[model samples]
Target: MSWQYVLELIQNILISQTGIPHMTWGHGIMLLIALFFLYLAVAKGFEPLLLLPIGFGIFLVNFPIVPLMGLNAEGHMNLIEYFYQYGVASEIIPCVIFLGLGAMTDFGPLIANPKMLIIGAGAQLGVFVTYVGVLFFGFTLKEAASVGIIGGADGPTTIYLTAKLAPHLLGANALAAYSYMAMVPLIQPPIMRLMTTPEQRRIKMRQLRPVSAREKLLFPLIGCALIVLLIPMVAPLMGMFMFGNFMRESMMVKRLSDTAQNSLMNIVTIFLGLSVGATMQAEVFLNWKPLLIFGFGLLDFVVCTFGGILTVHIMNLFLKEKINPLIGSAGVSAVPMSARVSHVEGLKADPNNWLMMHAMAPNLAGVIGSAAAAGMMIAMFQ
Candidate 1:
């Protein structure tokens, strides 16, 4: 071959062999943002397991010339987009995550205090309230619904509903969902304090009535049927949640159930984190939408927290017994974080009162209620 031709061929090969391609100002900025998240995750201990990987993924995808995210003219999808299309868009990831969540969760608290279900429903006020906020921002109904879902405080439910309705906003929505989750300690305490006085916060909760194994056994099956029949669109998310819980409760598939709750979940979480971070490439991350998404998410969390507190207060007016309003803060649906914060806040008010079990009632209810709300968004959009 001629020397010139040989040199040209070598250059092409090098370009193709290395993941690096090009760089831009936007990518550089995203790299910094990614590092910020990493710092928060590592030093601050803010959702480290999730945020650390997410920050790393963002860094990898934004690096100069890296083909990790497939942003070239050829437009071949990288691993992130592949999962986004097959698992996320197809609505598989959320359901799988739910399966894992169900395996990890204990429904004893919720089942024991079924009356707490109302607080869970009330907590969903943020979803609808934020829907109006998004609408005012000029988003169409579908987009508004997508933004509003950040209030649900459940990551899988956010993804599940957004994938079904507004696929383009998935990255922003996912980030919002997780970011708000990490902020539960910061977001909930002020609201919890503001919503109730010292006396109310000091009120101790009654010990939960024992829930029979029979009640636990029937709950998943009946809840599955009830939620799905009522809102068929939400069935995928809700059904998976119930099915996983049933597998755990029934004692029939101990091995499968254990795998779902532990091994499978860890594996999926890694993939989900990396994939989500990859989507946060600079051009995508540095936008007004992300800010709006984050803001709406915070607003949603605040709304849910107070909604639960107020609901408990209202319920107390008619009922003979009074429920501690602090427990209502757990209705934000961030699993144990909101519940833990509720517990910690309660201890600060009164060291003698242990409200962990009480908060759990609303915490678990938020999970189901969020899924139900997500399902409603899906149905309306579909």
Candidate 2:
């Protein structure tokens, strides 16, 4: 071959094999966004477990001509696409994550104070309200439902519902849910303080009654039955959750429980995060819809926090022993983080006032409430 022909062949090889020739402004922006997420996860310690894998996935898939999130020439699904299709789109990973959460959860606080269930349900006010609000902004019923559930602060439920109803919006919804969840410490405290007085924050609750092992073991069965009867659409997610909890409470299957809580959970989490982040391809994510979702998500969370505190004030009018309004903010299903925020806020108000156990009642209740709300929406739309 002539030297000129060889030079042209080498240039063709570089263009085909490297992303540089195919890169666009969109890819550049997405890469920078991925790096920002990585920095947050690594340096700022913001939801490191999920954000790290998600950020990496975003980085990998954004490279032009990469097979990470698409089908190959032979039509075989690429790596992240396989994970997205089978694990996330098929609605398996989120339920599996719930199983792990159930395995690690302690339901004693919720069982001891069943009334906290109202606060949990109350916190979902934003879900329905935002549902109505978003429809005015031109989102369809399914998309609005998916967006509204972000208020619950339950990442798995958000993923689960969005995958079922509006799979196109999954990445934005999941990111919004987790981002707000990670910021629970910052987002919730101010609302809690503004909603309650010093005396209300200082209100000390009585110690929860001791729970018998029999009660613990029976709870999952009873809770599952009631939830399924009420909203059968949620059977898959709730079934796995209660089954995992049953295994934990039984003490007869310690190995299974441990595996669910640690190994299986971690494995599913990696796939889930990566799959989610891969969906944020610049063309899909950098749009007005995702921006609106993010905006409504923050409003939904704020209103949910406000609703929870408001519910407490209303309940106290009839409650013989008043609850600390601060615990109401824990009614969003960020789990122990929101509960701890309540405890810390209480401690600030009264150094001797301990609210962790009490806050847990509403926190755990929020998990159930959010799942139930997801079930309700599925039933309505599906």
* Tens-digit lDDT string for candidate 2 (23-100): 999999999989998998899898888888889888888989999888999999999999999999999999999999
Per-model TM-score, in order, reads: 0.92, 0.98
| Model 1 alpha-carbon miss at residue 318, Å | 0.9
In angstroms, the error of model 2 at 370 is: 0.4
Q: Model 1 off-target regions past 4 Å? A: 1-21, 70-76
The residue pairs found clashing in candidate 1 are 20-65, 20-66, 21-65, 22-65
Score candidate 2 by TM-score against the native. 0.98
Please give, for residues 1-382, the per-residue lDDT of candidate 1 as tens digits.
8999999998998777754456678887898888998898899887876788778888888876665765456877766677666767688878999988887778999988899999999999999999999888877788788889888899888877877787767777877788889899998899889989999888887899998888888899988898899999888888888888998888889999999999888887777777777778776678787788788888988988888889989998997778889988888899898889989998999999899999988999999899889888777766
**Can you give the lDDT of residue 260 in candidate 1?**
95
State the displacement of the C-alpha of residue 32, model 2, in Å, after optimal TM-score superposition.
Answer: 1.1
Global fold similarity of model 1 (TM-score): 0.92
